[model samples]
Target: MSSGKGGPGLPQERKVVTEIPGPRSREIQERRLKAVPPGVGSVLPVYTVAAGGGVVVDVDGNSLIDFGSGIAVTNVGNAHPEVVRRVQDQVAAFTHTCFMVTPYEAYVEVAERLNHLTPGDHEKRTILVNSGAEAVENAVKIARYATRRPAVVVFDHGYHGRTLLTMTLTAKNMPYKEGFGPYAPEVYRMPMAYPFRSELDGPATAAQAIDQITKQIGAHNVAAVVVEPILGEGGFIEPSPGFLPAIAEFAKANGILFVADEIQTGFGRTGRLFACEHEGIVPDLITTAKGIAGGLPLAAVTGRADLMDSVHGGGLGGTYGGNPIACEAALAVLDALDAEKIVERARQIGDIMLPRLRRMAEKHPEIGDVRGRGAMIAIELVKPGTTEPDPARTAELAKACHAQGLLVLTAGTYGNVLRFLPPLVIPEHLLNEGLDLLENAFGG
Candidate 1:
């Protein structure tokens, strides 16, 4: 174990002052269970009192190294000094004038920043929303309006969100979509490149996928083809090298808008500023959230100026879409991301994490595949020497990690993939410490 600096007002060492769900955390959780809806998933039983840099300090004073980044919402780190200060200053000036009602300079400034930051250099426009799902839904609406088509294509095992329209876009169907749909119609599912399990190589895989889509869905009728550059909930699966480019080519030929869902993979989570940059494929539209505003609720859709403008004058926006507070927080987050060299840190994190995960995969036959880009990584667990998934063991392994002070998340259609979304601000030694716990849990 090693000790390193964690911004201001943080401990030099991780101190477990109480048990996993310490007395204070349990008390707060008891109250939370009664007040908050059960639909929201709580990973660990502990309730966090404070967080900064890379550590989550529980109510009972147990400082645990945060590997989940609040589900990748704090890539610039929790309660970042700059973000906190900016949010505080903004809140004091005005809480919510409602951009649609009175408007604000912060909102326009955020939109300008997003226009410059997103993939395309072509003239672009942005629409800020309150959540990733909202951004995605709006993207679909814009695409359908612009293309005058009915069909939307999404990949198998993809997760868009829980909203009705997005649930139709999502592939998984249990808790997110089980009884909730009766989903919106005209969304189609296609196979994504999963090299570890699929038999075909990169180009072949892309060809077969495009062929199937063209044959069944008839590309001309498709309004948009939405994809995650690096599949987030679908086990952190990165598309084969030629896969995305082929799909982009197909979309171009068919007059389909290509939308990149960067909710989890954007803002330097995948080493590159955007995962699509890794393959040099630019989408017509990109949906962003999670780490975009550090920890604030801010999501955006940036796309070709023409397509984004297709919506009628009053068709886009919400009352709280681009609240001043969130816009200010987003600006601070962008500043921190640049000043702290977060994209480089993501690459550095991958260097430490991937090798450790690969070693675990080698020793454990249950680990079917190790994959992902940069800090957004995953290990797909399976029955030894077979393709059969082992979700039971996957859950057990996650529990083991949690017990040992490491927080991990599970994903995949079969729930057999363990994903790691550590904050980019996590210190080298602290990240290794989390990995050491993972190693111990895996019996290394």
Candidate 2:
């Protein structure tokens, strides 16, 4: 392992020199509980001091193998050399003048890159934002403005964001939507093309969604049909093939914009520039984040020029929408995506992990499904004799993995899915090691 506590180029191996949450981490957690509100939750309680490559070094110097790349935000790895260099240079040059106030070249450059990188060769425009939620809100705003419609159609098990409108768009209730009631109006949740649980196929699911749109919501009243090409927080479920294309076609035929929420699956996370490309669907608007700016807070909405330009002047920007440091980081990230062959690396990761995960599934009766592509993969847990969700076992498995120095994330509407989103830059050895830990967790 590269010798270091934290920062880039550290050893890409897991070293559990202490308990998962050692004494130092326990002290920090005690401090955190008092200082931070209870609503702000964390999956792993180990406070991180440094993170790089495939490992995160905790306060107690325990290096854990990362199976979750900060929920897919660090696809290019944390503290990449180019990203660090660009961010440092941009910081020294100037912190923020507010793109809306005086404007800057980095913001425009980031927009241009997004416009070019997103799906479809058609002339497109972009608006940068602070987070994925902001990007989704902006995309919906543009679609509504352009289409002159009030309703937005979302799918079951879709996760947009935590903001007011996005929260309404999301389907989960307990944690995301539970006491937060009286959500935004005119946002409709439709049946998703979930291949594992639902009996409907791709074309059939699309037909049902279309029927609901026309009969229930009225097609003309719909502004957009927003979906995660592959569901993210809702268990990394990849919909049945042909489902996305059929939906996009219906949306286009009805003059409704199809928005692809690529926040979790964009920027080389899924072996492609965007997950929507896997199904050959070109969205009218795409919301991107999580992996856009390395670890920096940056998101974007890129779409057809005509639709994006529909918004009135002074209606599309935010105070810190495109901070220069983040823009420069984004530029560096975009460059590194190509320069380092990160997209190909994601595909290679899938090739190595999927088969191993399948083998693990064969031995574990609790593993009901093994799904996802590239570096974005997951296994759903179920009862031994039936399809009933086994969230308790899923949590137990994750905790076991954590104890063994493998950091894993749990998701799903039922909370029974264990998702693995390793950084594309993670070493092959670490990937194998992480999977081995996961297999061992299944045993216990």
Candidate 3:
């Protein structure tokens, strides 16, 4: 058995006894076609039967190297024993009272812990939610309520969530925004400081963005300026050094709330507890979800007390928000983050990925850029001799890795970026092997 929880943890090695999907997974996929909706996209059609460490074992008994971490939700690892134990204990005690109706100590404890752990030590408040989309929506609601403004400003290449307001806030159009509008009104957009693509420096980009908001949207009318300190879906574009702090500074000075959407970059995934910490950008509101409760569905919008408190009672909750079971799992995840040194582990992941990627970039002209912080990193693929996005090549590389039992996730507005979000608990040898497999894909 693997040392920690999260089901029967698979071994550290990648083993494929059958084809990538194998026969059993293919049979299950056939069943899924009849039962599940076509809207639900499966990253890997091979169903995960047992997952642990750095591997996910499908029902066909194929063990694949995990590079996605279930889209960065399992930082500690799948079915982490500690998280599993907490969930089991909580389940035995009582599963749900609908926190809104019955209230639970675990919910309050989780809120208290978030208030303390998030960036600023000032008086803060946290409202738990069910997913990243919910957390973001609530943050926008709170900001709009507190600021009494009709407009919200989001940057270019920033992905908030899938809900109406968030999809409006999201810069991507095809899959996320196409056919989904008429989106929420009064959501304004500005250019983000994409160093690789933009000509300006960090401060210069910030200046231009602020200027555009002031001229185009009128900063006074904007309720909040939402950003991903490190862009999530729009590519793992780490805003240039001064970009985030500059944006936050503008938001504060202009009576606009700065909302950090840390859904993909939070909870030790970015080498820090929050990606904002990397730039000393303490936003007025921070939305967290993905890595908060291991594999559990839990999210929170933690923010300044006065802003969050501005919303009236019964205005900021859902039936499933902050369920006791998710709270318990989150508490255990927090313990693992602190005791097991997850933040440092993320830094170590970057240390391993950056150097190897940089070397690979040196050799492969198709790799246009290698960027990210801590474990949340990516490589942008482009034409061999130019900066034009090469999405076909990117897809080909990812498919090559998938064929070899290495699970890799791709992202970017151009769909030419391959992201790596390995679990912090991934074994070093497994990580090395995964990288080696990735290199082989690039070589082919």
Candidate 4:
């Protein structure tokens, strides 16, 4: 790793002064067991004290190289200077004006940015919300309100969120949808054109999916077709080429809305402003969160003006929908995203990471597929000589990496994909260092 030249407040090296969850963190974990519920789980529960650039410092003074970015939330880095400054200033001025009550310009500015930056160039409108689930639920609400249709088409191996409606929309059944029952109705699941597994090419897969949707759900009854350009929690699956365009085209042809859930793929995570851009598919509505506000709780649904306007003003807001602090942070995030060259950085990261991961796959027979774009990448783990999911190996490898002071996240419906979401600000040397740690963990 680089000796110095880390970002402002973080070092560029992985320094493990103690064992991975040292005595101090272990004590905290005991307290946490008493305070926090078992249902609320964590991949790594070591209790972070400070984080920035590419490293998370734990309570015991060990610095672990971050690959999760809090699940793609810290794209611009933790405690980004401009974001911190803006939030500090805004907090001092007034923490909460409650945009729905007193109103604020920061909220409006964020909406304007979302309207301008999202896929569409046409006249658009934006509504802010508290989380990605809220954005998604609101998108569906708006689509139904506009189209007066009941059925909403979703895809397999897609994750929306944990809210009642979004949990139903999510494909996985275990943690997200298990005990939660009576999911929101009128949400239909469709086949996704995952390139690695599907036999058909992109266009054929799209055609097959469209045919199934037409026969099963019918064109006139569908309100929207909600999809993630790159299925995030579903193993970073990049749907085959022409799949998204076909879906978007069918949605439009039938007067149904196309909603692109960019919650995990937005703000340069996928080497583009939005992953839909990669397919040249301009969606009718786009949901964004995570990386948008530099770790603040914020999400938005930006859409066509007419569709958004159909909901009426009073129908589409919450008291804390556009919290002033989050808005200010988001404004700062946009500025940093542009000024720091984050989009370009994402592409550069992919350039460095993809080759290394492909090389690793070559060495490790357990690696089934290395897929995804930009900083949002994943390696699907499978049994040797077959495509059966190897979640046990994935967990073992993750534990080994954690022991070595590296943080990685696992994803996929089968829970066998190791996803890498290192912050765009992560120093190249630190990233390489983290990858080296992974190589060692995997016995390379």
Candidate 5:
């Protein structure tokens, strides 16, 4: 199938006018402060006026090489023509009918695509939601309903969402979970295999973790074990080779559902369509959001049909769940992913980025570790020799990059990991340019 065309086309090259934020953006910021909430923090002072392919043009006419990809949401690149057209057409023809009342074909089609795309050959079903957190919350509900158990297991440093239930599931304390308390109960935390810091290898660490959990919590009492194949907010840490598979086996033996939170690692971000595919292990349930709709707000839980069916006919839906426009945008994203070879492009990005990051780690003693899968990569900053996190240095580096026209994000429980989620469609030269800025930030 040919890629559909719509939305504004990408410019041939990036252009910078005035400084990074420029004057117009500063003016807009001043205006925004008068009306907008103070809770929302501005990263780079610039406000995006247009974006296509791999670049974002701010209101001040400074075109930047987009490295953030809107927090890894636009894997197919910003305003992908096909996605834009599909969304545009969808908006024109009945924007909202409340899928619970008058369902649409696009919703079903998107679900079908997810069922087919997610890891596993077994019969699978899907439930679409508005965001990654909603998908995770619903997945937990399904698991509990299916097993008749109350407790759900999540890994340390694993980030599920910001919702009440997921906040309890999340490992970080400050900002996301601070004072947001009275979180939903029955959520348990377990240590994930952090090879850089752990004493045991992959399988040994997995075994140790499982043993502790089963002994303390009783695996039989747990409804599900949630993990990120490649840790997202927890510094993009990839579980040691045997860790995930071992955990999967334990979950299966204990009759607990294995849930893979692929909100950040799914949809070709990690070379494979799903990060779990690397282990050839199929999770009982997979939660996905970012990159699935190429920028539209859409997320889903794809899982074994039997477990999914446990929920009553009307129990597993939302009023605006699976918005038709978002569904259409998702379908377009899938088409672009396949026809445009985006999966391969993601692999190419990883090939270009990993080596450069590794070299950076070699030169900078502050870089404690460089890790990730595919393009979903990160470099953790430490206080040289010690594993002690250096969030202050991470902040400095990010600020430096931002000033020089690159946008980088910091993650990890300690907030000392610098993650790169550049668009797969970004030109090779532009990728190198971003890397050069990063090198300069590190004192190259």
Candidate 6:
């Protein structure tokens, strides 16, 4: 694809030099079975030796076009120049002084940047953490502390994380929650405004959610209403119009903190700087991670100053919460996001992908619905002539894409959605080529 050439290091083109899991990868997979637990799964079996631009070079020398940016973690690319430079410099200077131990300027800079970037103009505060789940848990902790309430309302088809509390918050039961109990208590599930499958429209869905929360959990007893503006793992489900605003309004009216989980849709992953911006919903608290720090482990909870400051200083920190290297990486990521005009690039990607996928959907009856915004897009597959989920077909299509050197990811509570998350730096030609491979996979 694209003349089988690359600038330097990892290429920007896809080249299938061997079978999907070539001999080398197969060999490594054997070792992995012994070393790694089966519970920790991977979408692709090929082991990556190096990755950059739009391709991942596996140990077998096959260059696959990356459609899943490590589940939206590498929005700026896997090895962004500025991020690499900052991380290297920080590592050389000192890897860890521990933000909670000695403190660091980069951490403060990152906090300040998040406070300014996340939706909302009012005075805000931020606490840095190590992962999306940590950010979410901390956000709930802060909300509960500020409101002195016990109940936290989440939505059906939502996925927060694998931690005890987040697992309870997540809606999917299979791999995330089934046997993990006893889960954290006080987390209640509500109906989501999924446009494709829902019987109700946006406002009606909001009404149902509000009514359920009011009747099931008393308004005064609820601490927060956590939502993903565009649900990520549960599928790139952008709730119908007017849904988020109504929910936010109801939350405010009831004194329930509205928390937007932008972990997968933040830092230019979506066309906007934040997905909530698309709906004009200003959440009382927001959780961010993944794309926040290139590939480094980092997350944050930015919220209203009063709510954030409610918890005592010592009550909100970790030994490696804001590791200096992660902070430096985050700082670089924020700079790249603005300097490279990545948000605009994300919009451009959405412009290219949405139309292409919609056209593809027209040709394939198996594709039930194509949805999502920006680089974060997905297509839900269904049984022929019906709306029922077809996870088997979804898995088969993903396997076909992988065989053709296109890396894609699957999501949805039913596991019937094919999701894409190309890096912001991917060239247009590479994107087109990847889509071509996907089209061929569909045909096959």
Best candidate according to lDDT: 2
TM-score of each: 0.96, 0.98, 0.98, 0.98, 0.96, 0.97
- Inter-residue clash pairs, candidate 1: none
- Tens digit per residue, CA lDDT, model 2, 224-298: 999999999999999998899999999999999999999999999998989999989899999999999999999
**Total backbone clashes of model 5?**
0
RMSD to the true structure for each prediction, in A, is 2.6, 1.4, 1.8, 2.3, 3.0, 2.2
TM-score quality measure for candidate 3: 0.98
Per-residue lDDT for 165 in model 3?
81
Instruction: Output the lDDT of residue 231, model 3.
Output: 96
lDDT of 6 at 407: 96
Per-residue lDDT of model 4, residues 140-210, tens digit only: 99999999999999999999999999999999998889988988899999889988778887778878878
Global CA lDDT computed for model 6: 0.91
Per-candidate Cα lDDT values, in order, are 0.87, 0.92, 0.91, 0.91, 0.88, 0.91
- Model 6: per-residue lDDT, tens digit, 176-213? 89888998989999999899899899999999988988
TM-score of 4: 0.98
lDDT of 3 by residue, 1-444 (tens): 123223534567889788888898899999999999987888789987778889888888888999999999999988888888899999999999998898989999999999999998799999999999999999999998999998988989889888888889899997898897799999888888888898888999999989999999898899998889999899999888898888888888999999999999999998999999988888899999999999899999999999999998988899999999999999999999999999999999999999999999999999999999999999999999899999999999999999899999989999999999999999999999999999999873
Model 2's TM-score against the true structure: 0.98
TM-score of 6: 0.97
Better of 4 and 5 by lDDT: 4
Clashes of each: 0, 1, 5, 0, 0, 0
Off by over 4 Å in 3: 1-9
What range of 10 consecutive residues in model 4 has the weakest lDDT sum? Answer: 1-10
Residue pairs that clash (backbone atoms under 3 angstroms), model 4: none
